[model samples]
Target: MTTLGHKSSMDHHLTGMSDNTVERPGERAPLVLNMDKFSQVTATVCRVSEAERAPIAWYICFTLSLGLLSVLGVCIGYLFLTGVGVWGLNNPVMWAYDITNFVFWVGIGHAGTLISAILFLFRQKWRTGINRFAEAMTIFAVICAGTFPGIHVGRVWFAYWLFPIPNQMEMWPQFRSPLLWDVFAVSTYFTVSLLFWYTGMVPDLATLRDRAKGKLQQLGYGLFALGWRGSNRHWHRYERAYLILAALSTPLVLSVHSVVSFDFATSQLPGWHTTIFPPYFVAGAIFSGFAMVVTLAVPARELFGLKDLITLRHLDNMNKVILATGCMVGYAYSMEFFIAWYSGAMYEKFAFMNRAFGQYWWAYLIMVSCNVITPQLFWFKKLRTSIPIMFVLSIIVNVGMWFERFVIIVSSLANDFLPTSWDSFTPTWVDIGTMVGAFGLFFTLFLLFCRYLPMIAMAEVKAVMPQADPHGAGAGKHGHAHH
Candidate 1:
């Protein structure tokens, strides 16, 4: 009788209701909804990977992504054969689409680490739903970002020189260059993020291993599962490793993008040289990264039938972040002009003026409208909660961010100090194809990750669920009674 009463009280507390009671107006909604069992969570996430056939949408997306990947390959091959002259690299506009795309992709990679490491450290339970794929996105985005500098070096074979390894010729990388800083910063960020991502997935991989049917399936999943037996020791070590990796990754969330920003901030170019670039770049990176997350989350939830696991609450929270970061980006934008004018340097003032009303005024307009104006719509609760609205806004934010980099790079460089050397930049077919191909690479990898790996962190999600509580309901009885 005591056990029964205790179970009843626990159920009531977990559900926030009973037979005759109602949930209060201010009560927080449950993270997982429309599901009552841990098995259901397992089934929902695992089925996508386990199912023999994926949805038609997956095939359609895969086909398109593969085609684009081929385009990227062909473009890269052509560039290697024909030389960098194939790009629209003019006198002053030596840096254009390549750097723009590099920065854009690097920025895109930021949100995942922030969501996984920073939020995890803060004990944000809501991150459980989206962190898995976000980490995957981070890895893939870095892969895409790394491609640019590899090819941008022209002699792709000598790219190994970017590292500090000694050679027969005693050629060494210029350690002081921010460009070298990018090589180390980005590589370190990727290594830590990959470990953090794989560590979180171990238990889920073990779950998949147990549920796997065939011998081949068992072997494959088992290998990655690292013999995870869900024992107390296994879990204790996993938690420790995860916490340590999270700590290591937290500074990287700020440092990597800041290093990327240093590539420009360290330069003497009028618009490029700004102390604000570090924080500003970090904000824009997070801003664009969250937008990309939302961009992926919406379709993923709908297509994979993961609405219960990744609920509206998650989307709402992410949108709120987008809004907050969007504001930070906007503030950064205004400050650029303020500081330029405040400095009273003719060239600095001219750079700011030229960005708003110069040869590339159209790009500037697109950047402002997309980055500044579009995210403002999220200020309204109705719009923020609406799936369709947020998706469109997310994409728009990324487009604006791309243009933001374009305006920053092309505008400043195209019209440098010497009027005689000023040249209007134009992207050739190869330039457009290479950028598009990077997208293909990103999506192709993401689709494969979604198909093979658990998209949601099943272990973390379960940890957040009410039933996982040690003291709830059958706590005393379960402790006394053997399994």
Candidate 2:
């Protein structure tokens, strides 16, 4: 119904649908399948949301997630009705499952912002296919993460005390406290991430609005689309806002994790006190985040029939990132040991030794093998490119990262300088159930998102299409010269 005379030509050129070939020289392997038409792209991505019924796997996963979420709820409710004593928290091991799960989910959220903000700033076009889903993952991961620290306070009702609220009592949070720092950092991150996600989604929502068949669908999408009308002015404004959000988000990716690390770094604990924690935590966060993305995306692309858009090339690229970050994490692990030994501090040296050969030696070994050793499989093209291998490895990476937190939190506190105060910690059923429930919560939100929202950003994907680039070399071949 809209004018396509000029746009159709551009689309044809960009999509490589016309005689004027848009293929770059030495076009090695196709990133996307050769079908690059704008209409096809739209049809492929939007079809999921607009489908008559979701795939059976979606229902199966959704139902399972709900069941697990219920378990989490029960666990939390029990904790509230009783007390923090329901957990296995002892004197030396006060932080166990709660802190471990908090750090794990927080780490999981990093890849989304890194891909959405950092990669976007760097002009990584491959990110287009996966950014939307990864951002959603980030948001859900943060929600799951935030739930932990809130409940970890024991008296959930007084959790608001962590916030700086001006009231009759006039109590304010201590700015110097690392815990308070986390509150501000995580809250700011969640806000900006949500805004960035929603802003990017607007134009695509507009596409849905225009294409919606039912009146309710049209109304729902129209309300959120903000009256987008494909005008050049609207496009210009949208791009500017998107750029600003991306720029803002880039530093946040670094800062949020850095602050999270400060919770440990500022401490006097042997294993926790270190200068390398910021970059080390950041690297580990990105490593785990990418693994989670791959884990989710591999199944999703297959089950959702999005193979062309979320291609093997995309998976391969993500695996490369996982490998790179995994190496960084491995290096950090090695450096930590070396630094401890060289520093000539008895407590520091013992802390490193205790971690590797202490009562929790199995946990440390799992962390090292999973985080450091497993990802080296990616050096082979066949392994990185193989979806099955990458998916399994991704899950392993998450497991390793979780244990990494456990090793740091429990191992350090359990065998500190004073041997008499040292003790081993075991998680209660409540602790286990609550941690498991966090996964349920994360997947539940993700499943609902996949069911309702466009898993892929259509407009952004289209923008990268050849026809969308008016001044490309291919445009000149199409009797259209760039001014």
* Most accurate candidate by TM-score: 1
Error of 2 at 103 (Å): 0.8
TM-scores for all candidates: the values are 0.95, 0.94
Clashes by residue pair, model 1: none
RMSD in order of candidates: 3.2, 3.9
**Overall lDDT per candidate, in order of appearance:** 0.90, 0.89
lDDT of 2: 0.89
User: For model 1, how does the per-residue alpha-carbon lDDT over 311-369 read when each residue is reduced to its tens digit?
Assistant: 87788889989999999999999999999999999999999999999999999999999
Which window of ten consecutive residues has the lowest lDDT sum in model 2? 13-22
Candidate 1 minimal-lDDT segment of 10 residues: 15-24
CA deviation > 4 Å runs, candidate 1? 1-27, 473-483
